[model samples]
Target: MQGFTIIEIMIGLAIGLLTLLAIYKLFATSEGRRRTTAAVSQAQTAGALALFAIERDIRSAGLGFAGMDPAYLGCAVQAYKRTGRDPAQYSFPLMPVQIVNGSELRVLTGSSTNMFIGARYSASASGVFTMERSNAGFQAGDVVVGTSDTDPGNCLLMEVTAGAGSDITGPGGVAEDDPTVRHLSSGYTSFYTGASVTPERNGGSSVDMLDGGATSLGEGWLFSLGNRPTRNVWRVQDNQLMRYNFLDETDTKSVGVAEDVLQMVAEYGFDKDGSGKIDKDNEWTGVDAELVASKLDRLMAVRVAILVRSSQYERDAVTSAAPKWANGSKDFVMGSGDDWPHYRYRVYESVIPLRNTIWGQQQ
Candidate 1:
């Protein structure tokens, strides 16, 4: 047998090592590509979901049962007075106004246990308020109350009369002895009326207007526009999007609607002349006629751009092999900082009706 030379053996070994290295490289490249594709897919899916949720909510912002309307029952009482002072003489007619507080939104309409008020209610410490319910006794177009009332205390409890025709007396007297005048109670049924049988006072410590006074209108009143303890904020923290609803005084539910969102940016569009355009002079920054009209016409669509990051991108870093996939950039950058990298994402937006805001201009 011929013995192999050292040089030839060394050459053979070198060639074999080279071939192994080539194979390793090929596998590594393929794996990296797979990871990159997965990351991109995940980012897209998450981003799309986030954008969809936001758009849906924004589109329905002033719609559905919560839509902006004079009949929303979320209006604040522009003016109110006790119909009469006599016993069983508690009738307070209110002029309906926009929902000035956020907390009152949930209680505006009566629930299963409460009768509908047909008008909105508000709890504002500030003196400025809109007509919540028309003066109790006036017909449509009848001007009973002045433009606005300065005395915030003038707003008393609201009453739903048993019958119609405004036969109810002021809070100081019995229902105007008219047979048309009907007796009404806040309780759902006689079972809810207690031994005291005292009609609940609006400002009292525990005056229950609905559900047999077990719950008070003021309980949810603190969430009004001006009283919202904290402004609603949307931001990304720890790779997850967070929404904070800060109604400090009310028990309203706050929610974080989405996750994996890297960033969110918003722009307000203004339509001037009822003709949609970016008319700088009529931008939404001011409450001008054009701005107001645009808002009413849904000409002011909210543009929301959201960036979603990949959930599994960082896992490869823990492995011994170098990450094969290249980390890509994101479409949006949060704030003024450009240090962070955003992944694949989608942008979603919609226009909403500023029902009360626009109608106020006509008034």
Candidate 2:
């Protein structure tokens, strides 16, 4: 038998090593690509879910009784306590669309009303008054609005306490009736006998006509009162989108809506010209968020921006692309600074019009 030469044996071993190395490289490349695609998909899913939730709420911001205006939709009434004796006992006023320097968002929703009870059973300026409707749906601690029966345009908002025999009270919570405390007109009048009465809850209330009556309260467009999921706050904390509903008694704890949310920025759009339409060029983009907030009643649209990130780390040692947004005076970034290459990111944006605001404009 002829023995193999040393040169030939060495050549065969070298070729085998080269083939193995090529297979390993191919596998590595394929795995890296797979991981990248998954990360991108995750980011997209998270961003889409977050945007959808926000848009839904924004669109329904001022929805309430028929003909209710959006301008009156955003008022933060004290959150109701689930375990308390009275859920509406401790709520105070909070803005409907409250933004913490453009970082977080708070929204108020309106609860529907049962039919209007009859006119004031008896009238007195004292916070309490009588109604023709039974106390079946109406209860103590319910927020109700009283309007003029003759000029339904004249209205006063009050809380129900100690309901019995068609009697409802607690306007301004004053035992002794004060004519000066009237939100509609001094002294409760028989004119409210047939006025509309609607419930106000879930961060929604009828427009308190400070200058008296703006228009006649329409038929069936009256008072509303009830316990409902009418308000909540949305915010990004610890890379999670959390919702807090003070009005809900069952779940008082903050719940996470989505994950990997880095930041949220919103801009208010207005129909500054009173032309019944919102245009970007005429929007108030002031750096001071409070100024924009002051004009919330006039706001016609809202522009929201959300930043999302991948849940897993990418293997790349360096990356040339990163996400960015112009937030206020600073450039908002994702996976920015020294850790830019470790993750992937995306930005989701939407502009929602305020139906309530538009309705008010038309009136």
How many clashes in each structure? Answer: 33, 20
lDDT tens digits, residue span 177-255, model 1: 2222112334212212322232222223212222112232121211111101122334555665555432112122345
Q: Where does candidate 1 have its weakest 10-residue lDDT segment?
A: 219-228
lDDT by candidate, in order shown: 0.35, 0.53
Work out the TM-score per prediction. Answer: 0.45, 0.64
Q: Stretches of candidate 1 above 4 Å error?
A: 64-233, 244-258, 276-299, 311-363
- The most accurate candidate by lDDT is 2
The reply for model 2, stretches above 4 Å from the true place, is 3-7, 65-95, 113-226, 249-252, 280-282, 286-295, 315-336, 360-363
Q: Cα deviation of 316 in candidate 2 (Å)?
A: 4.4
lDDT of 2 by residue, 1-363 (tens): 998899999999999999999999999888888877887787788889998998888776544332333333333333323242244434433233445567767665555354322233333333334333433444444444444444432343454433422322457764532212122212222222433333232122333321222353222112343334255678888888888764543234678998888888876676666665665454645333543445455667777888887776766644465555543333555433667667777788877776644563455
